[model samples]
Target: MVKKIEVEGYNALIECLKENNTGTVFVHFSGSLDENGVNWCPDCVKADPVIARNVDKAPEDSIFIHCHVGPKAYWKDQNNDFRQDPKFYLRCVPTLLRIGSPQRLQEDQCCSDDLVQMMLEETEENVTPRY
Candidate 1:
């Protein structure tokens, strides 16, 4: 079963993953660029803490996704039209999974379609859900 959902910024995304879980976890990071500190739509990050500690917290073989959309997302601080210091772009996912790698992220195709594709892939060879 898939558990947990989030609408977090790049920083929040990482902090969330640090939590514990034993089930398949599905996260939807914003793929569209907002005007502030938000980037839940940039990319999908997966790994098992044990094997990759980034995906699910299952016994061994598990799936998990860490996502981010773009830089300067969310309600911008000080209402500055989402304008931010270019240096900060590296602090978040520039486009998708290229967290701290704005240039690379911008060149990548990290969008809703990516999320759908990933979900579809997981569904295709998915194990028997414990639901």
Candidate 2:
């Protein structure tokens, strides 16, 4: 089953992490929403608690994604990796799954039905399982 958090906007990503599920979420920031005023990056701000709770868990792969804002990069590997938007960040569940924490999904405006369909085109190249 897909587990998720209902948040208002992409800016609200951090708040979703603060919810009760208690797991690491990776963020990808690559757009015009200004992060300068937010003090700490939303992804970093939210990761503190999740990291604290996951002390003894699998440390290597449990990180959530939070990329820098503004013009993004094309992160495709020569290994046929599924490429996501420069701004596309994710909270891949396997790490959480390995540590026995449920995956925490946050609703994004870009996560519209259209985007969902468009994104699925990468399924064959999926390095990780998505909901």
Give lDDT: candidate 1, residue 55: 30
* Top-scoring candidate (lDDT): 1
Model 1 CA deviation exceeding 4 Å by range: 31-131
Q: Give the per-residue lDDT of model 2 (tens digit) for 36-121.
A: 63313344335333432333332232333333332123222322112232223333211111112222323342233333223322
- Across 63-130, the per-residue lDDT of candidate 1 in tens digits comes to 33434433433533443222243423333332322112222222233334443344323432344432
Go through the candidates in order and give each one's C-alpha lDDT.
0.35, 0.31
- Top candidate, metric TM-score: 1
Residue-level lDDT for 11 in candidate 2: 43
